[model samples]
Target: MSIVVIGSLNMDMVVRTKRAPEAGETLFGQEFALSPGGKGANQAVAAARLGAEVTMIGRVGKDSFGSGLLEVMKQEQVHTGYISQSESQSTGVASIVLDEEGENRIIVVPGANVEMKPADIEALESVIRQAGIVVMQLETDLNMVEAAAAIASRHGIPVILNPAPAQPLGDELLHQVTYLTPNETEAGILAGIPVESVDDAERAARILLQKGVQHIIVTLGSKGALIVNASGSLHVPGFPVQAVDTVAAGDSFNGALAWQLTRGKTLDEAVRFANAVGALAVGKAGAIPSLPRLQEVKQFLQEAAEAEPGAQ
Candidate 1:
């Protein structure tokens, strides 16, 4: 089985500082680093590392960043045949500021990412049709996302939509998504309810169910995720870990969830696996660099299980 990711690719420029800059105040940072990241690319890398055959469909510039991004994908064994180069734009870039606590504030320049259009999805119809699951995010054009979802819907392929960056989507898009994964903030935006607690998350998820989304997974950071469907709801507690950077935690969860589901795991099982992935990701730093491989995640899960009482 294969997973197709249709979204953005960016070179992330990260700076470590004591805290975010004030409105007009500028402070010097402690460290600077560049890494391959973007919602789409990070998720693809996360899935690929977990043994998923992932094909990336997106656009990048003809610049060095684009070249490096493609090379990173290739090195990770993610298929990049569908990734194109934009002639008139630079590769997308994310300016990330990380505070002492590993919290981040990011500003993105869409650049070539904005060039990905609905036509791009049409041109790759065959690729999408051949995938076991199609994954997408809000980092790209909404129309393109909807187009991809529509294609997957017509072919009866399951579509996983990660509603990141918290944008308001229409019912047309929601109806096509087989699974919708959103953090608490995003769930609040989409469901029109404040997601402050587990009950709040469930209420918000119920609202999304009313909007036609088949399944809703509300990621609650340290609280783990709330999985809701017509059957009922399950709260998968998070794996406790000392987090260093949370940049790729959500992406790791999404990728692992898709991989586990494609392997025929139940929603509850998949979310539990995803929670382990997320915990491992936050223990490290950077985006793609932080995503744990299959062995690491498995070991972490095994250790956690054995650490419990009454083990064999």
Candidate 2:
């Protein structure tokens, strides 16, 4: 299925350390490197690698980081025609700190990402109207996100909203989305409750359901994902893998889910495939570098099946 991602593009500067420092203390030990990231670009490249036709619609600065990000997306087979360059703004950046256990903390500077306005979404109306599914996130301006969602809604396109960075959302936006994917922290914020277990996630989803979101998916790191909709709720188990860095795991899941849904997979089937993609992502290090290709995911699942019959 053809997918369109409307979100942010960032240059990720990653630092690996033993563990996160305290309020005033500082400690560093491992390595530092630059990577291509931003939820939008990560998801786009992910679905593209999985054989979906994806177009990225976002703004980037006319800087080295922006240039590299565009180059990487093209290399991954994601269409870059819709991405625009902002001469006045510098490229967005994400400062990430990673611990030995693959856990991470991130601080983002929206930069050019936030420069995108509703006009930008209107300018690309035709492109968005043609998509099988339109994927979005909170890295960009809320108005722009709402604009794209409105366009997708007018055309009856499926809209997937990955509300990250844990912010409160309005009912208008929630009603416009077909799917709302939020991690434990994000779900907790949206539902006004603490979320740490499957039960907590389910309760939070129920609260969100009252707010008019069509479907709610709460991603629970190693515990897997819980899906809640008007009809009912279901939990899909995650695969066990040695995680190196879990930077883009959720992005991989969203990408894989969108790709599968576009290809006519049932919601359950898509979630299972996404779980595999996310597992593979956590096994690797960076954002874009961690996303698995179609064959890799197939093989991963195949091996899992062979190792433990019916495990996958």
Candidate 3:
């Protein structure tokens, strides 16, 4: 089964600061790094590295950053047939400040991402309809994401919604989602309930399910992820590692979860697999470059299982 990611592509410019800047204050950073990012691109890379036949749908600008981002996608074996170039706007960019605790604050300039229109979705509807899973993020226009979800629903193809950079979502969009995975903050924003802990996550998940979401997965940073469905909820503990960067951990989780679900794994099984993949992702440093290969995931899972017979 193939996976299609419909979203944005961006070049991330990051700085390592002691902490997030306060209002009216300027902080000096120790270093700077440029990386390949964008919720859509990161998820595509995560899925591709996990052995999925993946295709990306997004827009970039006629600039070096856009060119380099496409090249990175190609290197990850992600099909770029749906990618387009924008002459008027520059490619999307994210300016991020990462602290010593591996936490980050970001500012995004939508750029070409703001130009993604319904026509673009219609143009790629055929490829999207043939997919086993269609993953989307809020980095692009909300109407575009809604349009894609509508089409995916019509085809009976599952749509995985990762509401990153979370914003207000309409009931119609939530109802169309087969699976909704949001981090604690995003879940809090959507559910209108606190999701600061595992128990809080479970509460928020129930609220989302009541809102017509079929399934819910809340990423809890180092505490791992909470998986909730009609059956019940499960907390998947994260692996302990010294994280150099946590930028793409959530994207990796969403991608791996899609991969497992497409392979017919149950939600519980899929989340367990995804948790391992996400943990491994954070132990490394960039976004796309940090995604783990299929063999590596296998090795990590095997070793973990050997250590504990009853492990997930």
Candidate 4:
């Protein structure tokens, strides 16, 4: 029951400023930090920390960032067999700015992430086939995402798509997806509806399901996530936590959901765990450094349980 993530791996430069900059404006930053991040890497780390056998498939440049990024994956116990280094392109990068309110504005340079070709997926066919869940984001080449989905479909592996930085994809692509998890903005774009509330989320999710996605999970940040299926919908509200940075909160949710599914938990149960994990993530700073381990999650659940009024 391994989880495979096929997406981008990037070096992130995060800055904290008074507020997010406008289209052509610059502001003085209070602090700056370099971190290992990328939608792919963040999800992989999130899953690995939650006790899943995780494998990461992506590319990095043949530079220092590449070396360090590989080490980071190893440290997290994520299988790096499918990660490669390319000298032709530098590592992908994300320039992120967090305002005083913890809102972020980001710009991504695809770099080596864009260089990942379908052939890369083709070469990892064996690994892809062994996955119980294949998770993906839109940071890498969409062709590669499609190739992985195609292979996963052949093996009966469930494919989970998190269409972040939302882009247009096909019903063909949607048909191959076993689970489609998107934030409100992404759901709005994919379902062509104004997704401003839970009612809108249900409407949007139903539209995607009609397009052939087996399940739809629309993440609503502080509002938690809405899970929709043929049976109906359920809303799992977020845990109360003081948010310091919200960079990888969605990735953490996706990763935790995949881990729970691989462990044979129902989608409803998975969303509960994912909600807790995501709430914990935003309570800290930096993507990699903020991920909670399995033990930490266990402890959190225990504490929450003890705090409940209905006791022995």
Give the winner by TM-score. Answer: 1
- The residue ranges of model 1 lying beyond 4 angstroms of the native Cα positions read none
Top-down lDDT ranking: 1, 2, 4, 3
Q: Rank the candidates by TM-score, best first.
A: 1, 2, 4, 3
Could you give candidate 1's per-residue lDDT for residues 172-261 as a string of tens digits? 999999999999999999998788889999999999999999999999888899999999999999988887888888999999998998
Clashing pairs in 4: none
lDDT by residue (209-291, candidate 3, tens digit) is: 88888889998877778888888888888766678789899999999999999999988789889989988988887788889
- Tens-digit per-residue lDDT, 198-281, candidate 2: 899999999999898888988888778999999999999989889899999999999999999999998888988999999999
Residue 67 lDDT (model 1): 100
TM-score (C-alpha, index-matched) for candidate 2 = 0.98
- Which regions of candidate 2 fall more than 4 Å away from where they truly are? 309-312
Candidate number with the higher lDDT (1 or 3)? 1
Q: Report the number of clashing residue pairs per model.
A: 0, 0, 0, 0
Provide the RMSD of all predictions against the true structure, rounded to 1 decimal.
0.9, 1.3, 1.8, 1.2
- Clash pairs (backbone) in predicted model 3: none
Residues 1-312, candidate 4: write the lDDT tens digits. 899999889899999998887789977899999999999999999999988999999999999988999999999999998898897999999999988777788899989998988887898999989888999999999998988899999999999999987998989889999999999999999999898889999999999999999999999888888999898999987777778999999999999999999999999889989988998899888988889988888888778778778954
Q: Answer with 1 or 3, whichever has the higher TM-score.
A: 1
Q: Can you give the lDDT of residue 127 in candidate 3?
A: 91
